[model samples]
Target chain A: MEKKDKIYEGKAKIAKLEVDESPNTAQKYGIMSIPTIVLFKDGESVWQGVGVQQKQTIEAELNKVAS
Target chain B: MSAQYKVVILGTGPAGLTAAIYLARASVVPIVFSGPQPGGQLSTTTEVGNYPGFVEDIQGPELMDRMRKQAERYGTKFIEEEITSVDFSKKPFSLKTSTQTVTADSVIIATGASAKWLGLDSEQKLRGKGVSACATCDGFFFKDKDVVVVGGGDTAMEEATFLTKFAKKVTIIARGSEGNLKASKFMEERAIKDSKISFIYSSEVIEVIGDNKVDSVKIKNNENGKEKVIKIDGLFIAIGHKPNTDFLGDQLELDKGYIKVKDNTKTSVPGIFTGGDVHDWRYRQAVTAAGFGCMAALDVERYLEGIF
Candidate 1:
């Protein structure tokens, strides 16, 4: 929780979805794997990275999109 | 987004997390780069009955999550970054991810291994739908259904045997005759003894038939070029695993693609050490990899004393 807060830190919001519980959302996004991180800006998915990603990289992307 | 660290570990599996736990407890502050599969192979597995310490079997993902949190509790910094390349020619080793580069005084290569897949378009298209690599991970989903495992090796035997627990029938698609199976005698017998398990010799899966999910598999016989379709609820690929060392870029010695270690965890190059499946293809177990991680951490501490 602390790590999550630090990564977002009011710069953005984060939501996690379990693909198994939400098959429709997974199919909508064409997600084929686990641990995929998608960044949405202005209600549109602007950047997406599959697999585990570093917080720094995520934060960097968040900054870019937030700007 | 570049930073420097005294120690950097390039995986987040049992091996890397164990190394981070040890190094962090010693105040080394190891920065761990959680590669593509953050928790590595075990996370994709289902029941881990052999990892020890638990009264009952633990779910593979839960165990890995506990290990990761344990490492984090000890102040280990985890980055969800897959290293793209490495430069180990100098004192400070440089590792590059897609978005940034970082340097470390000492690096631990516990990058682990990835499962191999049949290179077919249909197979790629239906991955995770019903095509899977770990039977223990996906077998429960196939309860009372028919499943096909492709391979003739020990892993294939193991997967087929495990799948018998859930699948109504488990079939092994082998590329060779029963006499020439790559599985050990014991493993072959274990799988053969199961009433629910069957074998198709000298055959290979040519295509995975699926739309939203796996429906069946197209198999071809190598001897007479006859192809057949088998109805199955799931497909499990158990060919083998390849170590994740492509990013090392010839910086260290390799033995058949796995990092070659001379003295336990010491790789060919100094200041660069390895643990887990990246260097160990023999055991390839979570506990053994974690043990190797501890050894590498201790080695890193000693090497740092000599250099720094």
Candidate 2:
């Protein structure tokens, strides 16, 4: 999506959270599970899923985010 | 047409590989899927002394690798792939991996369970460096040294008991009162009878203190709202374990997130079987997991014969 620039941007970011890290910061924005991916547009979550997901499905989800 | 194997085993842990050994010896070809953790939980562990037949202590990963080699010697083919999904609602069950889909006459699920740990930086930093979850695996390393076991459940009691055989002193850090043990009366009585064991009830581990290895633990007393430090050489997390069965979906019956199997290692769905930590919560030892794995493979072979 970032390359195509069809009003769609998709980037995979990985963050490692240590145990001592505050849960408040991690739980904010309603993240309840580990390895969660949240799709946001205009600072609002459009879709959220946890664990490993297919690239095609992620692309489809980005379409929803773009619309 | 290439004849499909009689059984397909998921996971390459003691359970899966052991099953392959038995099935291959019984003239059944077993194809094993070496999941993300090829050798399962034991791979992450350092020393494994409790597993029988190893007169001299063996490295956990080395033991598993030898098991894999032994299974392969019996003609078991191993494929390194993570099962993305599975379909057990029909005969000749199908499984989807990251790259391919495979169908087998029967499937054995031995994905095993992962130890649950407190999300602490120090804990992660000290993993395999004095921070361990399996007392049976690492307790001997801490002989005559003080160690801390965290949790209020039966697993905690069991681990503390096992550690007493090696540790000079074993401290149980419970999140509740001493009287609030989740273990049965027998286990609770055993724990109380052991003079080497001490209960730090109503306390939770806030930080694991050490440099390259664990030297002490910072604990918070929930009842008094006070913090204190206890010196210990090792930390054993007995909180709980989560079975790796999320990809199983609703294809098989589950009991509290564990795969449910009958006495014969047969699941509710025919031609599909489960064993090891994935289906067992009572005993999570490697020997028990391997025993169940053998049972699941034999059961899969029988199931296939009954149908074909």
Best by TM-score: 1
Q: lDDT by residue for model 2 over B1-308, one digit each (tens)?
A: 23355688999889998999999999887899888767998885667889999999999989999999999998998886788798888767788886788888888999999888999999887775678877876575676888889988888898999889889999889897867777787887888899999898889999999885688999999998999998888899999889999999998899999988886588888788888999988889999999999888777767767842
lDDT of each: 0.87, 0.81
For model 2, the superposed segments whose C-alpha errors exceed 4 Å read A1-67, B1-5, B45-52, B118-149, B152-172, B179-199, B205-236
lDDT of 1 by residue, A1-67 (tens): 2576566677677788876688678657655455567788778888776545566777778778774
lDDT of 1 at B166: 82
Candidate 1 residue-wise lDDT, B1-308, digit = tens? 46989999999989999999999999999999888777898888877889889889999899999999999999999887789999888868899988889999899999999999999999977876778887775566677889899999999999999889889999999998978999999999999889999999999999999787889899999999999999998899999999998898889989899999988888888889899999998999999999999999999999889952
Q: Which candidate comes out best when scored by lDDT?
A: 1
lDDT of 2 at B177: 83
Instruction: Report backbone clashes per prediction.
Output: 2, 2
Report DockQ per prediction, comma-separated. 0.23, 0.02
Which sections of candidate 1 miss by over 4 Å?
A1-67
TM-score of chain A of 2: 0.60
